[model samples]
Target: MSSASKDALPLRHPVRVETITLRPMTFEIAAAQPDFAAIARHIGVASLESLKASYSLSRNGDRVKLEGKITAALHQTCVVTLEAFPVALKVPVKLDFVPEAELATLAAGDTGEGEIDIEVLLNEEDPPEPIVDGVIDLGAITLEFLALALDPYPRKPGVSFDETAPEAAPESPFAALARLKGSE
Candidate 1:
């Protein structure tokens, strides 16, 4: 991979896809011990015990496809109880990287903004990703998938949020007058 492409990736723990070909390629990456702290902070976890990912890459013409899974063990604070707990997660990953030139060509022909169907794009079998500088950053991809898998409002077991209904709007000051008016 070129130096510029390398620089585009996260500096702490980078899992870059350098080579692209029709033949299948695979990679196994583990976060370095020194990078754990930074990664933990990035993921908003108390601590990250470990993070590992395995990826397979293949190319069809100019489009690149990546399939992988990430496993992570971490500590997180419960949103309801404010207590820290351990969480182990496995997240599946799949991506299709389309060339920028091709995307540009498509964009050039897209003169009608309202003609685009967002629902169709969202429902596609394979989510399309833009290839930046002819490379894919698997480490960043892993993080993104990890975030998506995590529960935004994690709660400890047996913890339930019983939201007490707001107190009845302070008895209206004009209640007595209103009651009298109604009776009359």
Candidate 2:
């Protein structure tokens, strides 16, 4: 295999916050999901073929900025046909992590979990995430993006709701009564 392909392979990296200085550290890393089957089951998908991310980390003041893109391939069951179909995604990753100790005070009535009404929540950006123990879990962050990118209701190409399809006729009350009597 060519060296270019080797460099493209996803590699796992656990970066310590202290290492990220004013200069941006670029990475083209990807890691194979060893527990792909189990995770696919938990994610309610047919299967996960691949998930990879390529990004850079830089320190801006006290916070660390993570900017990258996550690419994933998976099979999702179509709601219309109940058939699994392939899905490819290229999701943008942009988040900032601040030292846990330096986190700002919670807003009024905030549960520290950060909450906003639906209307404002749609437009508001999330607060910076906390960098716990000075290490960043790049794998976990990439997986999170994949989860968010999945379609809640997936449909295969050329498939749609068929309102013209025949529906099963409802049984009469007497039919159910007769069935119970016959069973007894």
Candidate 3:
């Protein structure tokens, strides 16, 4: 989803497609000791105190699936109060990677039907990313998912946006006359 996102994240872990097979391989990936300073700058968060990723990679013919979890603790400035608050994220990463040649097929078969069911909507899959030059950047891909999981509007707990509803309109200047005329 973010091909044009920040210039290829710093922690690059390239996995060659030819190396994977039907058997799944598990891997844990992360920057040594969080590197909160670097992550905050890359993703533009108030601060990313911790970040971790672990997943299993498996191949089925041309489709490569990365299933894992990305855990992170960050601080986002609240849009309502402008105060930085802590937020914990556990994003599920199910990135699908396919060769450039086969990706075209996935895009061409999109039906125009709109989804209405909550289950279907929640299960909507992300578009498959291309395995460029026989390599997939799992580190960058996982971080991209982390960035997407950030809340655009982060409000601290107990904060509520209460909008006052209009109570009643003031009486018109000719209110008494209008009432008397109606009685007649």
Candidate 4:
């Protein structure tokens, strides 16, 4: 799928923007029946369930911020043994979104952006096309951030490391020399 298609997938629960304000805005959401399968798909995993995000969002001017916790259970293939392992995560997430123009200004040695991109700014190397809508999608932002934080190699408990077989013992040169001397 195209990157645009992937990023544009409908958010299970979208945060509503009541009014834009210069002051930091805060709100909480208890995700309604989160689509774990969809989330897993976003993370390139299979069959995730019982996922939820209880998060708060804040905005200051053109910069948007998200701080929250996500709890979920997932089934992932172990990188070592290839066995499926169930992993649970409750992670604290924080991120920031900044306007592209402001980011450029910062890169040009202007500290005037006020460090809004310090936490979760888009990659400087390949920044995303600027979000046209002043409104930010905090739910989508948090989910993507959580996906980045997931363990790529989840292992099942009690899995043992492989042991190498011992090598055969070699004959001692001193013992051979002593036997030859005795025979002489």
After TM-score superposition, the amount by which residue 150's alpha carbon in candidate 2 deviates from its true location, in angstroms, is: 0.6
lDDT of 4 by residue, 1-184 (tens): 3458646654534444335455555555334445555666777765576666665555566666666777767777776688877778787766666776776665556456655444445665433323334545655655676677677666668876667787977779998999999999
> Which sequence of candidate numbers ranks them by TM-score, best first?
1, 3, 2, 4
lDDT of 1 by residue, 45-156 (tens): 8888899999889888878888889999988899988998989999988888887777665545665763533333665575477776666777778877887888889887
**Of the pair 3 and 4, which is ahead by TM-score?**
3
Give per-candidate clash totals. 0, 2, 0, 0
Alpha-carbon RMSD, candidate 4: 7.0
Per-prediction CA RMSD (Å) = 4.3, 9.6, 5.5, 7.0
lDDT by candidate, in order shown: 0.77, 0.77, 0.80, 0.62
The model with the greatest TM-score is 1
- Candidate 4 lDDT for residue 120: 47
Best by lDDT: 3
TM-score (C-alpha) between model 4 and the true structure = 0.62
Query: Per-residue lDDT of 1-184 in model 3, one digit per residue for the tens?
Result: 4655535465667889988888999888876655677777777689877888898999998889989999988898888788889999999888888998788655555455643222224567766888887888877876788889988788988887777998888888699789989999
Q: TM per model?
A: 0.76, 0.70, 0.73, 0.62
